[model samples]
Target: MNFLGFFNITTVALALMFIGSIGMLVVKKPIDKVILYSIVDAGFLLAVVTFKYLDVAFAIAILGPVSTIIFLMSILKIDRIRHNNREGGPNV
Candidate 1:
């Protein structure tokens, strides 16, 4: 099945990973990093699926978003703390 004209799922997954990695390296902002991270994460999940590891793919689908949320929450908390410090507010 020449879906998207690709040889196989592995090729598609690898291409995704390569593009995401390059984007991650090039992006400067933290939010952009997160977006790139999601791309890389999706690539990894696709790779898992390609290997016929449905269980692993299910786990990744469940945990990947959780990890991304953790990263986003941390970024928000850090930014808030920095803003507070800059405004002479309490550092709590």
Candidate 2:
């Protein structure tokens, strides 16, 4: 593909990521925001791959899921805390 086409596509992908980040700021749930942030990371990966930046793409591919897993573990911990608190107090 032409570099020009790649540049255009990258612009679109980055725009989507920007919008997704804005959405995440207002999202109420931790898990939902994490998921949306992950999508934005995936969009960056897509742009890197499209631009033939394999090294950057590889790093993003490795780091993205690791972050997602960390976020998921945090969410699980939160749920556990909420469950523990729910026996005699307000819901989380």
lDDT of each: 0.92, 0.83
Judged by whole-model lDDT over C-alpha atoms, candidate 1 comes out at 0.92
> Model 1 over residues 9-85: C-alpha lDDT tens digits?
89878988999999989988889989999989999999999999999999999999999999999989988999999
- TM-score for each candidate, following the candidate numbering: 0.81, 0.70
- Residue 81 in model 1: lDDT: 95
Per-candidate clashes, comma-separated: 0, 0
Stretches of candidate 1 exceeding 4 Å from the true structure: 1-7
- Highest TM-score, which number? 1
Candidate 2: which stretches are off by over 4 Å?
1-7, 50-52, 88-92
Model 2, 12-79: lDDT tens per residue?
78886887798798898887888788778877887889899999889888888998888888888888
